[model samples]
Every structure is written in C-alpha cells, then in structure tokens.
Target: MSTHALGSAKLVLAQNVVHIDPAPAVFEAMKEGWARQQSARFLRAASITPRLRLIERFGEFTGQYPWQWTPAEGEAFIAHLRGGAKPIQMSTARTYEVTIGLFIEYLMDSRYGWTEVCGERFGEGPQAVFHEGNSVLHTIEYEGDPRRRPLDYDEVQALFDAADARPAKIRGQGRKGVLAALRDAAVLKTIYAYGTRRTESSRVDLVDFRRNRKAPRFGNYGSLMVRFGKASKGAPAKRRTVLTVPEMDWVVGVLQEWLSEIRPHFAPGRHPALWVTERVGRLSPRSINEAFVNARQAAGLDEDLDLHCLRHSYITHLTEFGYPARFVQEQVGHSHASTTAIYMGVSNEYRNKLLEASMKARLGEDWE
Candidate 1:
C-alpha cells in the first residue's frame, strides 16, 4: 500500500517501533505522523503541540483509539467540556472541535495508509467523528470578550494621568518602584498613542524611532517601526510604521523623557528593548498587562477595561478626528478596511458633524 515516511504503515514496520501494546503503538505513531505532516507545512512547534495534547485529551475521554472512535464519543467529549466548573468559551470549544476534525481527516486519508494500518492491527479504521451537525458554529467575527471595548477620551486621559501619578505616589510612600512606574506610564501612553498590541509595545527597540522630514519639530520621534505587529497563522510578525499625529503628539514628549531620564535608572545595559524589566533585557507581555491593570485600578475606571482597550481607543479617536478609513487601516496594519472599521467606535457628535457638512455642501453655507 502507499506510505509516507511518517505514515502509520511505514512507522509500524520500524525496528524501534513499539513491540508491546500494539494499540498504543499505532496511536502514538498516528500522533507523530500528524505532527510531522504539520511540520512539513512549516508550522512551528508552539502552534502544533497544543493540537497533539488536545487529541490525547479526546482519546482519554473516549477511552478509545482512532479506529474505535465514533461521532457519539466526539459529541460527548465536547459536551463534557461545556460542562463542569471550568467550562470553556464558545470560541475555544469551536477551536477544539475543529482540531479534532482535522486530526481525524489526517488519519483517514488513503495516501498516509493509516486506515489500512489500523484495520490490520485493530480490526477497524478511523472515520470522521465530527461534522456540521455536531460542530460548534462560529457566526461571530468578533468573539472576544464583550467587556473589552474602547476607553472614552476622558477615560484614556484619566488612565494616563493615573500611570503618571504612580511614580510620585510610590515615592511618597517611600518605595523604589519610581523608575519602573515611570517606564510603565510611558509604555501605556505609547500603546494608546500608537495603537499597538501588547507584544508590539514591549518588543520595540530604541532605534525603531524615526524622524519625519515634514514634522521636524518632533525630531526622531515622528514615527516608529512596529516590528512585532500581529501575524497570520504560522507566519512571521508583520512590520509597519505608525506616524505621530497632531492629536496624540504629546506622546513625543513622554517617549523623550522616558528614553533620556527614567529608563537609565533601570540600568538596562546593552538592552535594545524599549520596555525592560530589572532582570531581563526585554519586558514581558504579561508585565505590560499588569501595568494596565494597576493603572486602571488607580484611575478607578471600569474593572472590565483591559490593555487592548487602548488600541480600541486609538482607533476610535482617529475616526473622530476625520482620518480616512484607508489611512487608518494602514496606520494600524490591518489587512482589511473592514477589520479597521470594526475597531472604530466613532462618537455620535462626529456623525452629526458629518451630516451637517453634507448638508452645507448641497444647501449652501447660509442654509443653516
């Protein structure tokens, strides 16, 4: 029969293949085969390992090998996941179902000969256990937590104010967190000003800053190369340059003060990271998140607001400021204008101004 290097048929014939517990041998081979197949497609280990673990979890829950699996077991396992104290989100449940479906499809493909191998050893062959009827439907494009919306203009300023006050507040209480607090304040303002994701905020280097010839006053802080922009699945991080706009140009001073004065206290020698921790050259995404939480609590903003809301706020404010949709999309590095539009939560006042401007164009300036 047809066989590939990591195919079940080829693996079963190996000298080092498991000799006892033939069922377990075939099962392990199937997983290894699937992992190798995914590797060939250029997926990283971080992207592939969770699928293997989920398959193992499913196998354990069903108490059956691939050849012995049925739709009932797959449905039952998903149902079990939806129950218990730690029930998963619908998005997570859908992902699990999809992973199971992919794993089953891989095993049953004739070229791999897994079906033939399983039939010879276990008297059965793998079959599709998941289908449209049992799978979770993902109708919502934005399935993120509903609470994570954009901060209002005032809330954004208040958050910045709180982060700024943290250094003095800690120093007043006689602590050594003054420098770290200042760094975090700068980091938070930068995130809102640039509309960056958490990792993008932490991953920037000092050299990423660039000057704008047209806006020479900003002086080497006019824009930044976001080297760690969000990526497509299995792809490298995308890069984009976010320009300094007039509205949020205050971020220029914040960054200038941070790089020159406060950050040196951290003694980050030879470290290129824009945001650094005491022990590590680069700050972590989690620490960025914690900074947002502490600032939000200090500001007494809503508890539901998280770090991502800064990006949301940036998108919203840019829309209210009359930036073209396409320009905003490029600034934020969204591949689609539709994705950019979704993040924009323009104010009703802006809508009224648009209506008035349209009327004035047709009805004349004296019409009002």
Candidate 2:
C-alpha cells in the first residue's frame, strides 16, 4: 500500500512539472504577474526586462524553484556573489537583493494565487527571504565614488577651452564636423549653466527658454523650463524652471550664437530641439556623453570625470558663489537640501575665502 502511494505522488509531480524542469507552471504564472505589471504601467519594458533577467538568474543560482527557496538559499546566493573573483559593488548587491525580495513577495501574494498553487503542488510555498537585518542600509550620505567628484574651477575652464578649441582645430584642418563640434560645445556649456542632467540637456527645446523679468538682458535665454526633470518611481516626469544667474550670464551670448548662426546651419527645420545633430534631429544622451568623454580626453582631465560631473561642478560653484543652500537645491531640482549637499564638491580656496571674510567681520579689522 505504501509503495502504491509513493508511485501516485511521483505521477503527480511529473504531471505538474512544465519549463523549469521542476515546476514550469509556477514560472509561467510568475511571468504573467510581471506582464500584468507592464500592462498596468507600473514598469516600462526597459525596466521589466532586466528585472525578469535577475529573477531568472536568482532561480538558476538557487538550483530550485521559487516555492522551494528559503532565506538560507538567498543568503548563499549573495555570499557567492561577494566571493566571486569580480565581486559586485555594494550598491549592485543591494539592487540584486531588492529585486529577489520583490520577486519572492510577488509569489507570496495571495492575489496572484502563487501561494495556494505552490502549497497544493509541492506542500510548500514562497516566503520573504530577505529582511531588514540582512539587507544593506543607506548608511552613507555621499555614496558616489570619490574618483567621480566634481571638477575644480580650473578644470572646468580647461574642459570648456578644449571643447571650444575642437571646432577651431577641425575647421582649420577643413574637416566636415565643425558644426558637430560647435554643437557639442554649446551642449556642454548649457548643461553646466543650467545644472541639467544629460537627458534633460539632450531633451531641451528652443521654446523651453523663457524670459526672466529680473534678467531682461538675457532676453529669451534668461531661464530654462525643464520639462523632463527626474521623476520618482512610478511618477510622471518632474518639471522645474532653472533661472540664469548673473555669474553664468555668459551662457546667454553662447546660446544666442548657437541659435542664430551655428544651429541654423544644422537645418533642424521646425523640430524645435535646441541641440540639433548632423542628422537634423535632437541630440541623444549617448551623444552628449560621448561629447563630454572626447572633451575630457582632449583637456587631459581625470578619466573618472563624466558628463554628470558638469552638473556637480555647477552645484558646487553655485554654493561657492554665495547662493543659499535652499536656492541651490531648487536650482538643481533636488527635492531635499541633503541631496544638493551630496552634489557639492566645493574648493578649499572658496572655503578659505569665506573664512577670511567671516573673521574680518567678527574681529572688526583686528583679524590680519
């Protein structure tokens, strides 16, 4: 009688097994849940694909189905990653842990019916494997690599000089990319002047530039209406208008020249993109990054300096230029003052200048 019962259980297992080789139905159901998220607009295809890949990788690492997974298995997988020859960074490990945790949560959710399906099929069900104790914490305020810190004032000047010289050098050689080089220079300057992210810079439209009442000299280039500011998860794009400051007012003439002379040469038609490409379309973020890379190399700057460094430099420079912390935060579209502080990489010289002025005011000329 016992032998017959064992045979019956084996037949049930075999029938239930569908692509995972152990339990294909569960995998199919999990995929359907992911598809539901996509349909609900909770995630874009670009975001969904990578997360699905991560789930599959976790499943392969555990060598078991999701229902059979445990906290021990999840811990072991993270340990394996840390012990690998090319171990992942803490941020990357945290992302992996979060993705796995979310997947497990999906399976355990009663609304999806994964729990009941697993319990009936395997006499077990999924549970949360990652918890607060084992997960990484946001301990540090500034987690970005030190190598990618903001450029100093001299370095910013050198980078801009290199960008400006590119068009001149190529034009002297009778090269065909003079217009492209000019576009790159203007793009970099606009990003720095406006403290815009690469995507924001790339997405700028001619009509986005508005007149500032206080800065009438800048005309239509007095402020920028950024329609594509960074958004929080599952939220629409945030919008902010970055006003042109007195110190960076030189950008007004640069933009004027680009709009009147250089940009017209691109023949962008009525596309309205501020930065036009050789193809007469809006500049892409990838091209913006490439432009920065080329300029950094030409300037003999640090290899770690990326296009985002330009924004960091802008934030730090504004702080040094006597702008209040709250003002800087608003200019960069950061929701918190702490976020703006993280972007600041102020120079020692500026700090010293501040100290000197403060000492003179407090000592009443007694401070030498």
Candidate 3:
C-alpha cells in the first residue's frame, strides 16, 4: 500500500480511521485525510482549505458520504449549478469540476486505501464523476466577456486624462482627497503600464522596483518585480520581472512623480507597499478596481470594459508595437505563449499594415 493511502499519524486516515463510525464523522475524516495529503505535497492552506469546503458542499448536495458518491450525483450537482439567476462563469464551472474531480481522485486512489476502506464500511467508494464526457471542455482560448477588449490608443489616452483631471477637480473644490485621487490615477496607469492584475497591482511594494541595466534612462523604474502573479493549481504565487519598454516610457515620469511627490504625502513610514491607503496599509484589490471603474466612467468608456481591459490593452499594444510573443509572455508572467495570445486583440490597421509589409517583402510589389 502506498503511503498516500496510509496517511500520517496526525491524519485521521491513520489515527481515527477505524474509530469513526457515523457517516458524518467518516466524511469529516476523509476531508482531514485529503487535507493532510495536500499539505504533505506542499500545497498551501489557500488551496487545501477551499477543497474541504467544496467536498463538504458536494456531500451535502448528494446527501452521501465520499464512499457513497457516484458519477450521477456529480453530474446532477453540476447540471443544477449550470442554471440559475446568476449562472457561474465558464472558468468557474470548470474549476468546480476540477476540484470535485481531484477530490474523487483522492478517495479512489488504491494507494490511499480509501477504496478498500469505503468498500468495507459503506460497501462503495467514490469515483470520478467529472470525467471528460461530463465535464466542461477547454475549447475557447478566451472564455471571458466578449465585450472586454483592449482599450484603443485614444481610449487609453482619454482614460489617463480623465484620471489626471480628478485631482485638479478635487483641488479646485478644496477637497481633501487630492492625494488619493492622484494615487488612484497612478494605480490605474501602473496597472496598464505593467500589465498587472488587480491583485498584482495591490501587492506591489516600493522595494520591488528594479533598475534594468539595459535601460538606464528609466532608472529604478525600469523593471517591476511582480511577487504576486497568478498561481497555477497547487502552486505558490508566480513571480516575474517586467522590464520597461520604450512604448511605455511615459510611465517612468508617472512613477517618479508618485514616489517623490504624491505618495510621500501619505507618510507611509516603514510601510513597504507601493500603493498604500491612508491608514498606511497596503491598498486592497477592490480599491484598485474602484479606481479603474471611476476612471472608466469619467472617460465615458464602454460599460463592459473592466479593470482587466487595461492588462489586455497592454498585451495588445505591445504586440502592435512589434514586441515578440515570447517577450510579452514573460513581461505578463504567463506560463504559455497561447495564454498571452488570447489577450492580443490587434487593430484592423495593424492587420492591414502587416499585409502591406508582407506583400512588399514577398511579392516586391504593392496593390492600389
């Protein structure tokens, strides 16, 4: 028997395996055993804790223990989730399937002895109900809202202008939020400049900025250290160094002004966070989102466009500016080139230009 089936002394699979008699108690033990297995594999609490909740919820829905779960129950549960006043996103539904699938995996692995244990106690064991036949397929590259796209160059300019205008209006009204207004503007711009997610933007620290030797003109603002890039399954936060490009050189001034002139006003002594609240704490992702929403509204941009569009805009603009797909992928901390491609919503002008260039190079001629 594999050690995975025979969980550690601290885990119920080993200690209280036989003692647990009631179905409810055994179900709890299964969760505890699974958590132990996840931790043993170096998974974080954030990953393991959620799985427990998901398992418990699934058990509640099926009105059965892990040993009693079947493919039918899992399918029914997912079907029920597929329809509602506010249905789950495709990504979300897929995540539910993956989670349940993994939980079932844990219980059926013969090495874990759960199959044997369940067969002896409950006369059955869990099986993966979310197999390819019943699960959501990963067909589309982008499963997000169709309306969400990269802001055009003009829209980006308008967004920054709107954000910049807020501080002036606040000062004119004798309001106290001028500093915060400036901060929010800077936050929004930085998110665009660095291709940062809201969480990545909020998690940035002052010390994270690095001077790229290749680009001395930008100084310490040349590269940004993203310590909280999105994590893959059962992984820690991904980290990457995003180097500044000439196309986004304008951001250097913005960062300098915020660091030297504006952020100091917050008096964030000993607080390392690049973006701080008035309380000297790191700003939350929600605050970063609100900053984008206010800027979007002020710019009179499309309602479907959200904070993520800024990141999309960054990826798209970089591609248009002739940056290599690999470079863009690295800058944005994406694991795969395909994932980066999903963000590239190139303009029609860019396509026409590319076609003209291709004709010139290949045919050595141009059409009228």
Candidate 4:
C-alpha cells in the first residue's frame, strides 16, 4: 500500500473503541513517514539522524510507540536521566525535550496525518509529552559553566607567553615539530585577536583578510571576514567582518610572520586556508581546540579554562579598553549588545577604576 494509504485507514468511533494490532510493517511505515517529512523541511542528515534515534530511544524507554506515549512517560524518563549515576545537565535535558517535542509536533501535523493514522490503527493519537510546566525554562542570558569565565590580564599574558615558548621548548628537546608549534601559537593568538569562535578560526581563508582604509597602518590584515559566524536554527551561517582596533594590532605582526615565514613550511600549495595543518590541509576546529589546551596547560592557568575563554577575554578586554558597547558587539558578531555584555567578565580593579573616575568627575577632584 502507498504511504498515504496507511493514514487513510478506516476509523471506529464506538463507545468501546477496538484497536488494530500494529504490525512491524505499520511501525516502520510511521518511522519512514516522519523521516520523509523532516527531509522535506531541508534539515541536514547530521541533524535528522540523532533526532530520529532520540524518538526511538524514547519509545524503548516507555515500552510503547509514539502514538502510545503520555506526559507521565516523559516525566519518568526525565527523572531517570536526572537521578542516574551520570546525570545530564539542564541544557542537555532541555535539548532532549525540544527534539522530542518537535518530533511529536511533526506527527500531529495534519499534512502528515499521523494523528488520524494512529487513531484509526491504535484508537489513540500522539500527544506532546513536553509542556511549559515540565520543560526547563531559559531564564538566564548566560547559562554556561561558572568556571568558564574570561581569563584575567595576567592569565592572558601567561597563556600567550606559554604559547610563544612552545617552539623553543620543542627544539630544546631535539623535536622536529617547531613549525607545528608555531602554527598553534599563531592560531591561538588569532582566536583572541579577532574574538573568533573555534569553527570560525578554522574556516579562515588567506583572502578573508582585507585591508581597512581607516586602519592603513595594519596593512592587509586590518579586518577579518568571518564567513562562518554562528547560525540560527534552520538558517544559513551568519557572516561578519571584524575590524582591527588599535589595541589588537599585535595580530597584524603575528599574521605577517606566519604568512611570510612559517606557513610556507607546511608546503601549502594553492590552498586558501590561513591556518594549515602539517598535512597541508585546512586546520580543523579539533586541532584549534588542542592548540589551546596545550597552551593553557603550559601556562599553569585554571584547569577549567578552555578555548572559548579567549573569546570571552577579548570581549572583556575590549570593553575595559574603553571601546563602545555597540562597536565591541559588532566586532565580535554578537546579534545583540546583551550577548556581548554576557560574555564580559570585567575585573574588580576595572570596576573600582570606573567608580573612582565617576567620583572624581562628580566631586571635581582627582581620586587617583
């Protein structure tokens, strides 16, 4: 029978509804139907595969199919996840709820006719197991781990110094990874210099660097064309060009050294990538992450500090350097100024300096 024929099965509305026994073929057809509907919406296979698996796992958990699931089953599954030996985080739980909720919504859609199909076949229909009361509410702007705050100025210096010393340390040990070490240092510096995400840093092309007319002193590296900005749900990747401010002009020298002296060592023939791996291909985000991990460990910095801390440091340092909120927001490609604000972890010293400046201005006396 055609896929649509399953949904058009006859329905019984008697006081005691008789349920049709769901065959294996019938269950497989429903799964295929959901997959087809998701594919029609143009979702990537990478996104669709995990969601399909999530629904299947949920079905297994309740010992029932989608049409037989109830809100109580969902609540029990969530409780099990939270009370297990390896409890999932709130964000993770929220994502699970959202994914399952979307699947249920797709089934309940009249265009798919899964609800009618289920009613006729099993005398029931799928209900949205996740609701406002049961789901996690997104009440905070920043819900990331508290340990993942921006690095302080001293810590930033220590990290950069550690990165710079890596090649020398390798050479001293009679190792031959100096070029790779240099590449790592350059990548780490570029990440902080532009406040770029890890994927954005990995995706940089040599030609993505543009000369800024306003900052001619920076030469051809005055602005970065970020082609892989964070994308919204079901949307194309966002793009933004971050201009080189005077404070981060040190990056210009680093880029020049890498292009003219170091990157050629990798023998990157005709490749457009700014960061090339030892294999002469474009660097991956995983490699970028490893670079930061090595440097952070070498610096003896906080164990909790990760690669993203550099981006946070950039946003905080730029704010501390007296740049306007909107300028920093645009540079970091944050859709909202509030997002930029959330990334900032200004030091107590900086806060006191602002307070002192305010007091001096009001009292007409120098506070320093």
- Which portions of model 2 show Cα errors greater than 4 Å? 1-22, 38-41, 80-86, 172-174
Model 4 per-residue lDDT tens digits across residues 242-277 = 998898899999999999999888999999999998
Q: Provide the lowest-lDDT 10-residue window in model 4.
A: 6-15
Which pairs, if any, clash in model 2?
A: none
lDDT of candidate 4? Answer: 0.85
The full ranking of all candidates by lDDT, starting with the best, is: 1, 3, 4, 2
Instruction: Tell me how far the alpha carbon of residue 239 in candidate 3 is from the true structure, in angstroms, after superposition.
Output: 2.7
| Per-prediction CA RMSD (Å) | 2.3, 6.4, 2.6, 4.5
Candidate 2 lDDT trough over 10 residues, lowest sum: 4-13
Q: Give the residue spans of candidate 3 off by over 4 A.
A: 1-21, 171-175
Q: Estimate each model's TM-score.
A: 0.93, 0.89, 0.91, 0.90
Give stretches of model 4 more than 4 Å off: 1-28, 366-368
* Model 1 regions lying over 4 Å from their true place: 1-18, 362-368
Q: Please list the C-alpha lDDT of all candidates, in the order they appear.
A: 0.88, 0.84, 0.86, 0.85
RMSD of 1: 2.3
